[model samples]
Target: MLRTPAAMQDAERHTAHNYHPLPVVISSAEGAWVTDVDGRRYLDCLAGYSALNFGHRHPTLIATAHAQLDRLTLTSRAFVHDQFADFCRELAALCGKDLVLPMNTGAEAVETGVKVARKWGYQVKGVPAGQANIVVAEGNFHGRTTTIVSFSTDSDARADFGPYTPGFRIVPYGDLAALAEAIDEHTVAVLLEPIQGEQGVVVPPEGYLPGVRRLCTESNVLFIADEIQSGLGRTGATFACEQEGVVPDMYLLGKALGGGIVPVSAVAADADVLGVLKPGQHGSTFGGNPLACAVATEVVRLLATGEFQHRSAELGERLHAGLRALIGKGLVAVRGRGLWAGLDIDPALMSGRVACERLMERGVLAKDTHGSTIRLAPPLVITAEEVDHAVAQLAAVLAD
Candidate 1:
């Protein structure tokens, strides 16, 4: 194995130190594995922050990307590309929404939703401009844009990053009464992550999503689901909202929508809600480029089949059961849904980072999120055998 010191030295000298990543520099990857620069193999349990739902270098997605590249790679929103219509239509149909406004990243889609909600509040909901307030939950991660981070409750994300943007209010997650009290005549929308993926894969209390949806509907406030990390079969459903059987007024989707090839994100909602923006209001140059469109179309097809979703559900149960078997021995508790779960470590054992380092040494690669929790999200394509192998590694490492 490559010595960690050399890699850490190189990174400190070259790259920005924004993230404290594991000391493994991956050079290549496949369905469920990655080869580091030193040629050591490790199972990829983090899966590019849920962006690689289709796995690394998937043949079908790669092939389509290649062909589309050879044909037409870009044609900005100035005009139109042949692939845009098909992709938008397919994604909208998958979400059962009336329309979609494509963008290049999850943050952009989140910003688009915010803009649309505020405008709709003024024009449709009849609230005054600049007075349109959005209700957001604590510990939510939509993206890193200025406006998106403006609502964050994390000190690291918000500290000294201001004077912060305005027009947002924070609410305690999974608490319906707090959510209700946060609403006002100026409230335009309530934004939240369906499963809080970045916060140690925390699942909200049962009936939380449905309760929020009901409140939004009754209050006439737009409900927006930031499914950037939990959508596209990541949580054993097309969208995590499906688990609660509630449909939001808008869906902000990213990550897996690109099939692990390119950045593809979009906001899907009924025409009236998304219709507030005029032609010149907003857009991205590469938002609906031909190549991205073709790849995203195929990604939508793959997710709709529910094959990967089924695999996640089945394997997730086995993985959880196996991890739970080690609970009192080393772990604090197990939490999550589908293939995405978090294991909280006991203080007497190692910190999450120490455990992740050990797991990497043993050929499994997962990263820690919060202080003592490691988020586990293998590619949905991983098999039952692979799941067992991952569990075995965790069990072995914790046993030590």
Candidate 2:
């Protein structure tokens, strides 16, 4: 018998019941595929929620990690390492920003962005001391941090988490008029996801982001784009904001930045906004460690070449076209851009969890979110054939 059952039971017994993972116990992965302990291979469509945007164990990223591991890893931000400056500089250049503050996870970057925005509001924008507010979309998913969840519109994430952190105003997403009305003299920033990944890969209306940019500029409020999930090569551009030709004042980035090797995230902005912090104000122990910098620098280099972005753009057309054909068949709707997509299966047929389970039985790995919606964010390294294969598996699952 395979060790899969025993291993899974052991994991369940030892760990917190936070995540209800699929039944597969993967032993190894490469590119866009993973193998179970039983030697069953499955196509990886979730792609670590876009963290593996470069694909599993990418050669360049792995090599960089290996090289750095042989020499040094963490320095705790106490002293600068050799890999630090280049990583910061290259990422800053990529973002068209003057500075980059590194953090370990997407949530931390969001928190960091919040802190900086508030500080900027006080020091630079002359907002009242404790009255600084941030306007966020209703269905936004920045992360699971306390401050982040405080403003979350999701009951699962917000309920029982507080006496929530104050000063955040929630407004309906894609409503330019509502957002404008919510902003006041105390508004410090407008934080939003260029494409909301968790809310079923929700894409806002076309002109929404550009309008936000204009409003933020006029109001002297920072426009912080939470690109943790929608950035990198997932949306066919380095950042999803780039799709709308909107450059936010601050970019909160994570996921693919670490090249699937380590937890790495950063907030990038120009000197005027980011410079609000002095040395002692904000820091992370493992933020810009040697191993993370080494891996992320290589990730930046990969993005700089624009190969992955191009692949996502071209392949996304094929993926979207294939999915759109399924709308009336079993899918209720399909929404997203590039290699990222959210498919809503007809709830009468199956829930998103059931659909994912069925897809898994057919040798595909995916994730479900919000009722009957399942998200597909295959790595940029995935081939056209693999993309078709995953879709065929979904069709088969739905047909059954």
Candidate 3:
């Protein structure tokens, strides 16, 4: 087995240099802990960017996947499989939506939602063809597709990725007035992340989501929530939008929906809204594959129990209380919801990347986004003791 630095160098030389990941190589994971190539263990505070809400290799999900694999892996949407309808029904029930369109990735789900919104705008909302407008919030990271990136506010993601797709309007996040002002007669939908995770877990101002819901309803515009990273109990709720008790017209869900095993995502909406697309209008070959559906069905059931959500809420309070106690010492601020937290370091102290490296050296793993903010989202299965250990390691790094 090699040390982390050696393995990291190998990846840098062989893999695409797209991500500036921490110099740690995990070889195995279970629950909230991971083992590096060198056999060193660390608390996985990042949890694959909230893709492991059920934790790594959750027994239920793995068993379901195994059984499904033994029975059937993929049938492609060209043919329906036994697992498809069950998955869709469970997901729709969990979401309290009328219908669900499965996809393989978060970006694909987002694309599905975008297509639905645009089509609904034309066919149902009666907006002119090619004139539909969707208002998006600033600092959003919906996906990497050209159309999705077109509305991105991050220069790094959008730079050199154009000529971008059109039909989008940008408004400052958490600013209801600006959002309302941006809406026009051609506006078909308003898309936003209930909590901006990629932007360092940037939670909106209180009541922002509720206000947006009202605005969308009043203006007769569809409200679409990109909950790819913040949904599925990541924010102490089935969906972050639920915190404000507002239901969007459609939901873009991914990340943990696959039970941290496969890439499973979906767009859930009412029949009239999602029904805009007739057969042959849109789909993916592996969208409703038997394997993904089998796994996701279990995932949806797990979310329905509210066990993970309650765990996140209780653990989040403890984690935040611990991190918040460090504020004004070395941490500038800590902001986030549920299991997700962002520790903003003071400029005078080490940068988030630096702190992350130091914490890794002390047996914990978390990722830094932007420059000064470290985002932590451990698997929901992590216990209070493990949370304490991770936080203690971070505190030790700050003290050093």
**Which RMSD values do the candidates have, in order?**
1.2, 0.7, 1.0
Better of 2 and 3 by lDDT: 2
Compose the digit string of candidate 3's lDDT tens values, residues 97-205.
Answer: 9999999999999899898999999998899889999999999999999999999989989989999899999999999999999999899999999999889899999
Assess candidate 2 and give its lDDT.
0.94
Candidate 3 segments whose C-alpha is farther than 4 A from its true place: 1-3
Q: Give per-candidate clash totals.
A: 0, 0, 0
User: What's the distance in Å from true for residue 184, model 1?
Assistant: 1.0
**Among all candidates shown, the one with the greatest lDDT:** 2
| Per-prediction TM-score | 0.98, 0.99, 0.98
lDDT of 1 at 385: 89
Q: Which stretches of candidate 1 lie over 4 Å from their true place?
A: 1-8
Alpha-carbon runs more than 4 Å astray in model 2: none
**Where does the lowest 10-residue lDDT sum fall in candidate 3?**
1-10
Candidate 1 TM-score to native: 0.98
Q: Least accurate stretch of 10 residues (summed lDDT) in model 1? A: 1-10
